[model samples]
Target: MAGPLASLKVLDFSTLLPGPYATMLLADMGAEVLRVEAPDRMDLTRVMPPHDGGVSTAHGYLNRGKSAISLNLKDEGSADRIKALVAEFDVVVEQFRPGVMDRLGIGYEALKAVNPGLIYCSITGYGQTGPYKNRAGHDINYLSLAGVSSHCGRADSGPPPMGIQIADVAGGSHHAVMGILAAVIHRQQSGEGQYVDVSMTDAAFALNAMSGAACLAGGQEQKPESSLLNGGSFYDYYQTSDGRWLSVGSLEPQFSSRLCDTLGLEKMKSFALSQNPEHQVALKKALKDAIATRTLAEWQAVFSETDACVEPVLTIAEAAEHPQLKARDMVILVDRGDGSQQRQIGFPIKFEKTSCRAEWIGKNLGADNKKYF
Candidate 1:
């Protein structure tokens, strides 16, 4: 069966993580995506480390299922070629800073002229109309400016750098996909397309969610380790005897009781429920001491049958081999454009009727140029 987004065609002029990742999700869902890149100025992902079959693994993963066409936007005829393509492709995704696309002559307004119903999405650090719109920024900067780092890590050492690009993927890529799809639905209803201006900083600011709600409405400024879920209580990670970590999130009364019982710290159950800082500190220390007495495997065995929300923190390799991830088919194989296939992460969303699959890994620059140009 065709995927739900099989009917849509996208012309992607984005490079790097944010926009490419967004379009990648679209392509994975069966949208016909044509990625346009510059021949002279190659995307860094194409040459990023960890090559498989002589191709950058990052590029292969991000651009899977999408066709590629190389064109130098600086050329005088490039705008005309894009305009012609825009007539057929109903959606456009770009990631250039503010005014860059306009100077290239293929901004939203120009493309919308070619296809009035085009869903044009631009992902940026700030927005097209913000005071800092033209300023250059990355994921870390966006998170810092948006106050995400304020309440994220240990107050003593400051916010630790994240393992993943939270602002890029969650803020920019995910939000852009959501905005584009919303615009698609709006266009379906009103027969009019609109430009989607996604600001990573803005999205990251909104990601404060519960903390932001308290700050805005209740005037409670959130700090690191200052809230229940943020290590203010016993609901946090504890190191085992072997130095492996176990995340404990037994926040509810019943679960906390079970956790305390399983750890042989039943006397600390009332402290787990108490909001007093001293009680929380004592309960946390007791839990930590108990967890440290056993290796991760030993603790895993002890908690395996218990109803408490406790689980070992697995490495990426361990996670890939985990039963739940394996059962969910999170790891998949994509064609490498040769006879063989390469392992990659699969689309996460499950559909009842429709299906989603990658046609192939990312292709060489201009691999589909003759077909489109």
Candidate 2:
């Protein structure tokens, strides 16, 4: 079966999580994505901790379903060689700061001269023309600036989720992929390609569209924990019996009632007043007391029959081995050439006739140099 993006060709010059993940998604959808890495200084995640027998750790996971080509951009000869190859690709993605690519003579202007239909993408902490473009920032900074980190965590922690690189992976990669596809469509029509500058900060702002809307309607910035979506007594994570944690999302009255019925809180309906914090406290305490009486499995079984909107918080390992995941084939182990077969998250979107597959196998550094160059 032909993949949805089978005809696309992407040149991924960006490194680390954001760029690799974006290009990897394209590759998974059967695009010929070639990752350009430096011979000397590759992505930091390549050498970062949790090494499996001292091989590229996080890089292997992120770069799955993509080809790798080693090029020393600092070396004029190698850079020129890379520039020549860039003309053949449909899309080019780079995560460097504003002027780095232009300085290297491989920016959109340089590449578009050779291939007029090239879709060039630049992913950065800040946008190309922003005042903060020159400043160095990471995922945390982007989330912080975009108002994402403000309402992320529990009120007591006063900190966001320790994991989940919201800005880099979600905002950066997702935006880059969308922009690249959009540019491809536009280029097909106009036969002219333009530079796509995707700032992580701007992308991060997209995550809070609903919150922004609520703020606009109220004519005031919604306070943390006050919004219905944020941490309230109803839609929050709670500890279950046997010390396990589960998230409950019974925002609607029907769902909440169903959940209460499952937990045998149908009789404790007097404490349903969650409009005020003090009332929410009484409700939370009562719900907690009921949920603590039984194990997570018990609650799961009870909610399985209704639209309670509850889920046990599974760790990454547990999620990988989950029955639903296995039934849906949501995780698969791909051959990494080494002894180990790397586990990868499966393709998210499923189309009926246009089959989108995770095509390429895991590759090491400079794996596709011969094929790409």
Strongest candidate by lDDT = 1
Off by over 4 Å in 1: none
Off by over 4 Å in 2: 267-276, 338-340, 359-361
lDDT of 1: 0.93
How many clashing pairs per prediction, in order? 0, 0
**How do the predictions measure up, each by TM-score?**
0.99, 0.93
Residue pairs clashing in model 2 are none
Candidate 1 lDDT trough over 10 residues, lowest sum: 152-161
lDDT of 2 by residue, 1-373 (tens): 8778989988888887888888888887888888888888868878788876565657767777787888888786765786688777899989888999888888778888888888899999898986898999888888888887777667777646548788897899999999988888888888888788898999999888888776668665755576667875567777888899878887677777777777777864545545776767777787778788788888777777787788988888899899988887788777766645766788787778777665445467787777766
Predicted candidate 1, C-alpha RMSD? 0.8
lDDT tens digits, residue span 1-373, model 1: 8888999999999999999999999999989999999999999999999999999999999999999999999998999999999999879999999989999999988988889999999999999896899999999999999999999887788898999999999999999999999999999999998999999999999999999999999999999999998878888999999999999999999999999888889998999899999999999999899899999999889888897999999998898899899998899999998889999998999998888999899999999999997
